[model samples]
Target: MSKNKVHYLKKLEIISKINTQGLTVRSVSHDYNISVSTIKDWLRLYDSFGISGLVPGTSIKYPNEIKMKAIEDILVNHLSKADVLKKYKITQNSVLNHWIKRYNNDKTLKQRGVGVRKMNKGRITTFIERIAIVKEIIASDFNYQALSEQSGVSYQQSYSWTQKYKAHGEQGLQDRRGKSRSSDQQLTETEQLKIENKALKAKNELLEIENQLAKKLLEFEKDVTRSL
Candidate 1:
């Protein structure tokens, strides 16, 4: 197993004990020599996604349907952020906040095509250069493609960077391709947990049904053999 999966299993073990053994988070933290906050976060994840949420090294993606449902629950149905989060198994208000912004802006949940353009001559642009290019685009009223030609970068790159910079300031320009942030990073922990938890629960349920069917099939085979 991957190290992340192993670590998840370990956390799952501790969380299971907390639930089954009726132990408090503090007590479990002391026993496992883990931080109380970490243990609490693990418990929250377990509660949200079961064992699958505890699985490490996997990035979860939410579908447009789920995103729309969450948005409707908040905007149309008038649910509070906490209520929406709990209902949808989301971990952060920021996710809903972002969704609301997109909805208001008439943007779709789908990523724009701006990021798909080929890089300029396959050369990676520096952060400083990217920031400068994005600023110029913004100053030019978000004429990203025009500015991209001048900056020797992809229009997609310029537009995407400008969007990120607009939403998150300069820090968003930092490349986060391979690194995994804690639940609180760009997306809230709860938001990610919800997606993973839902997927894991569905998988677990399917596996349970399959196991039951296998047991029945084995019993039927034994019975036929005996009769024959």
Candidate 2:
């Protein structure tokens, strides 16, 4: 198991907490605290995957004890990581880090921490979903109208997604459309009309060129008829 200074400090706290309560690493880590391997795994996760891995909480995607237990059970039963991910909906990265944390320096496996807890904020769920959408938009370079049509979210919601992305970087884009912008971001009808007018003028100029070419063809046909 790998860990950083912060994670090591957290482990010391877990150790102290358990010691004050007079518990062993096996019982304490499994019940009162996350496993030592889990701590080291989180540190490793931080080292390799960065902060996203160490974020404390559960995902809306998977919120069942039986399921979490199934993960540990599979690992204990000696099933592969790929197999665990297939049975459960979690990503391979998540499963790997979780198991690494669960086993840490301890060789034995335990089910004491199977108690499932709910994630705290409803807004976080929304924020994560919004971030996923914004990431898609940035990757594709597709704007709001296209996103609205494809995603079946409202036009206003799509624009809100972009604004949230532009303002908040990745974290701001997470699970939220964010607060409303000032009126200055809104375009007036007059401004919209001017834009439309410019487009129409450009189209009309293209049509005029096509019409002049047709006239030249007609003149050429008349000359051919007279020559014949």
Candidate 3:
């Protein structure tokens, strides 16, 4: 939930404690203040493939053998989607669902790459487009999945854009390629100027919107007072 990466060892330890200590998923989740879904995912991965399945990071490539085995376990053994997910150590049930769909349509078990392929995977998004998508996501009550489906962007992309927008406003959505601000030394004059300009532009836009909203609220209040 914090967006900070949890080490796989920590996840494995939590799952082990749940099993060896006979703790319920809800109890473990409440004790650690982690979401129940997160804990259950860890348990499923560990149970399905042992320690190897609990590896961290999203860029992991599942071998064709593993994919086929998962399919067989589900189709031939008549396992439920959840059961196959737990038995195959899949991180997302959607991955299995996609495989099932592909098998049904083509009778093949080929695994597609992660994320939406509409714009060549990590698409180069314009600042205006990113801002619009972020705004639409906010209008949809932060439904990342719905935003991804409707906008043809991956759910991870939608979520990441929203997070960047929240953290740094519109400028955060900018494609700051080849710019690293984590260095100890001062930034170059050009880099500093670019950053300052972006920040100023974003701030000015935010202030203008805030001023408009304030004026509208004041007018509405005055109308209400007059009517009363």
Q: Per-residue lDDT tens digits of candidate 3, residues 1-228?
A: 431377666776688789999999899888778898888777777665455455554433555445656777777778787777766567777788777777667533332222222331345565556766777667544555545656677656877999999999866877767865433333467755565565456556656876996686567546644643
The top-ranked prediction according to TM-score is: 3
For model 3, the stretches where C-alpha displacement exceeds 4 angstroms are 2-4, 58-79, 89-91, 104-228
Best by lDDT: 3
Candidate 2 residue lDDT tens string, 1-228: 233334433554554555476666567556644656554344343333233334344232333333445555565577766455545444335655665576443333232223222121112224444655555555434443344445555545655677866987645544324766545444467754554565456456656866896686567545644643
For candidate 3, give the lDDT of residue 181: 40
Candidate 3: give the clashing pairs. Answer: none
lDDT for position 127 in model 3: 58
TM-score of each: 0.35, 0.22, 0.36
**Given candidate 2, what's the lDDT at residue 227?**
48
CA shift of 1, model 1, Å: 23
If both were scored by lDDT, which would come out higher, candidate 1 or candidate 2? 1
* Model 3 per-residue lDDT at 96: 84
Tens-digit lDDT track for model 1 on 1-228?
222334765876787788888999888878777787667656665676555455553334554446666777776688877667667776455666877787677533323222233434324875556666665665554555445656787656776787898899867877678965433334345644554465456456656866996686567546644643
lDDT agreement of model 2 with the native: 0.48
The superposed Cα distance between candidate 2 and the true structure at residue 71, in angstroms, equals 54
lDDT, model 3, position 225: 41
Which ranges in model 1 have alpha carbons more than 4 Å from their true place? 1-6, 29-41, 75-83, 91-101, 104-106, 109-228
